[model samples]
Target: MEKILVVEDDKDIRDILKIYLKTGFFEIWEAENGKQAFEVLENKEPDLVILDLMLPDINGLDICKNIRIKYKYPIIMITAKTSDQDKIAGLTYGADDYITKPFNPLEVLARVKAQLRRYKEYWKGSNEKNTIYYKGLILDRNSMHVNLNGINLKLTPTEFKLLEILLLNKGQVLSGEKLFHLLREDEYYSKSTNTITVHIRNLREKMKESFERPEYIKTVWGVGYIIED
Candidate 1:
C-alpha cells in the first residue's frame, strides 16, 4: 500500500481528504502543522504528500524547500491561493503539482494518481542497469544519478526529467511548446514557455554552463531548445 501524509490545519478538510483517500490501496497519515508534518516525513517517508500552504507553525513553502533538500518524493500543494505566483512558487520549491481549495475530491485523486504513476515510471527506467551518455554527462537511469565532467551532479526531479528528454533526443531540436506539453503530462502545471525556460536555465546553472553561452542546451532563436554538441 502507498502511504500519503496529508498536512492541513483545517480539521474538516483533513478528515474529508483522509476518508476519501483511505480506499484499500492507500495508507493515510495526517498532520495539522508543518512541525508535525516533518516528523511524519522523517519516520514514515510516505509515497506522496498532500501539503497545505498555510500551517500554524511554519510556512508550507519553507517545508517544501526543506524537504526538497533531501528527498525527491512527489508533493501536491493543496491551498486556497490560486494566484499564478503561488503556483509557480510551489513548483519552484519542488512540488509536483498544485491544487486550489474548493477542488473536487475526484480531481485531487486523479492528480495524485497521475503523479504517482509518472514517478513510478521514472524510477523503473532508472533501474534499468544501463547508463546513457551525452555531451560529457552520464545518466545512470536506474540509479537516478547524473555525472558531468566525472563529478556527480545533483538534480531535482524536474531537472532530471527535462535532461532525460533532451538527451534521449540528443541533437534534436525540441520546441518549448513540445517540451512544455511533455512536462505537463507529468503533472507540472506550467502553461507557458517561460516556465520551461526557467527550469532549463536552472538545469544549465547546475550543470555549470553559462546561460550566455550554454554548451549543452542551446536556444534556437524562436525555434525551441536542443541539446547541442
Candidate 2:
C-alpha cells in the first residue's frame, strides 16, 4: 500500500482525512503540526504528502521548500486561503497541486488519486520512449531523469511532465489550456490558466533559461509555448 502523510493541524480535519484515506486503502500517516510533520519525514518519505499551509509551529511553504530540497515526491497543499496569489505562491514553492478549505473529502480523494497516477507513471517512465535531447539538456525516459550540462535537475512531477510534453512536441506551440487539459485529463480542477504558467516558470527556472531570450521553451505571446527543434 502506498503511504501518505497528512500534515493538518486540526484534529477534526486530520481525522476526517485519515478516515477517507484509510477507506481508499492507503497506509495513512498523520501530523498535527509542522514539527511533527518533519519528524515523520526525517525517518520516512511518504509516497505523497497532504500538507496544510497554516501550521502552528512552522509555515507550510517553508516545509514545502525544505522537502523540495532533497525529495521530488508529489505534494498537494491544502489551506483556507483561496486567492490566486496564494495558489501561485504554493506552486512557486514547489507544490504540485492546491486545495482550499471547506472542500469535500471526495474531491480530496480524487485529487490524490489523480496526482498519484501521474506521479507513478512519470517516475516509472511507462511511455517506453528513449532519451530526448535539446542542446546540452537531456531527458532520459528509461531512467526517468533530466540532466542539464551533466548535472541532474531536481524537478517536481508536474515540472517534469511539462518539460517532457514540450520536448515530445518540439517546434509545436502548446497553449496553456491545451497543456493543462493534457496533464489533467478529464479533471476540471479550475479554468484558470495560471497553474500552467506557474509550472512553466518553475521548469524554466530549473533549466536556468532566461525569460527574455529563452533558447529552449519560448513564449509565443498570445499563442502559447514552443520548444524549437
Candidate 3:
C-alpha cells in the first residue's frame, strides 16, 4: 500500500480530503501543522505528501525546502493563494505540483495519480531502450541512475526524468512544448510550457550548471531548448 501524508491546519478540510482519498491501496496520515508534518516525515517516509500553504507552525514553503534537503518524494501544495508568484514560489521551493483552494477532489486525485505514475516510470527506468549520455554524464535506463563526472549524483525523480530527456537528445534542440509533452506523457500530468521551464531550471541548479551559459541545456532563442553535446 502506498502511504500518503496530508498536512493542513483546517480540520474540516483535512478531514474531507482524508475521507475522499481513503482507499484500500492507500494508507493515509494526517498532520495539522508544519511541525507535526515534519515529525511524520521523519518518523515515516510517505510515498507522497499533500501539503497546505497556510500552516500554524511553519509555512508550506519552508516545509518544502526542508523536505527537499534529504528526501525527493513528490509533494503537492494546496493553498488558497493563486497568484503566479505564490505558485512559482512553491515550485521553486521544491513542490512537485500546486493546487488552489476550492479545488475539486476529483482533480486532486487525478493529479496525485499522475504524479505517482510519473515518479514510478522515471524511478524504475521504464523504457529499456532509452539510455542517454552527455560529456561523461550517463543516465542508465535500467538503473534509473545518473552518473556525472564518473560520480553518481542522487537525483529526485523529476530531476532524473528531465536530465534523461535532455541527455538522450544531446545537440538536438527541444522546444518547451516538446519537453512538456515528454514529461506529460511520462507522468500523465497536464501543465503549461512555463511549468516545464521551471522544472528544467530546477534541474540545472541541481547539476550546478550556469543558466547564463548552460553547457548541457541551451535556449534556441524563440524555439525552446536543446542539449549541447
Q: Which candidate has the highest lDDT of all?
A: 2
How do the residues 1-229 of candidate 1 rate in per-residue lDDT, one tens digit apiece? 8988899999999888887787536889999999899888887788888999988889999998888888877889988997878877887777767788988887777778877776676667433446788868998776678999898876766678788889877778999888877766844444456668767866887788887888888889989999864
Tens digits of lDDT, candidate 3, 55-171: 988999999888888887789999999788898888888888888999887777777777787777655535356566678778886666778787777665666777788777777
Order the candidate numbers by TM-score, best to worst: 2, 3, 1
| TM-score winner, 2 or 3 | 2
Which window of 10 residues has the lowest lDDT sum in candidate 2?
121-130
* Candidate 3: stretches off by over 4 Å: 125-131, 141-144, 150-154, 186-191
lDDT of each: 0.81, 0.89, 0.80
Instruction: In angstroms, give how far residue 142 of model 3 lies from its true place.
Output: 5.1
Residue pairs that clash (backbone atoms under 3 angstroms), model 2:
none
| TM-score of every candidate | 0.85, 0.95, 0.87
Ranking by lDDT: 2, 1, 3
> How many steric clashes does model 1 contain?
3
Tens-digit lDDT string for candidate 2 (1-229) = 9999999999999999988988889999999999999999999999999999999999999999999999888999998999989999999999999989998998889888888888887656354567888899999765668999899998888888889899999989999988987787645565567799899988888888999999898999999999997
Query: Clash number for model 2?
Result: 0
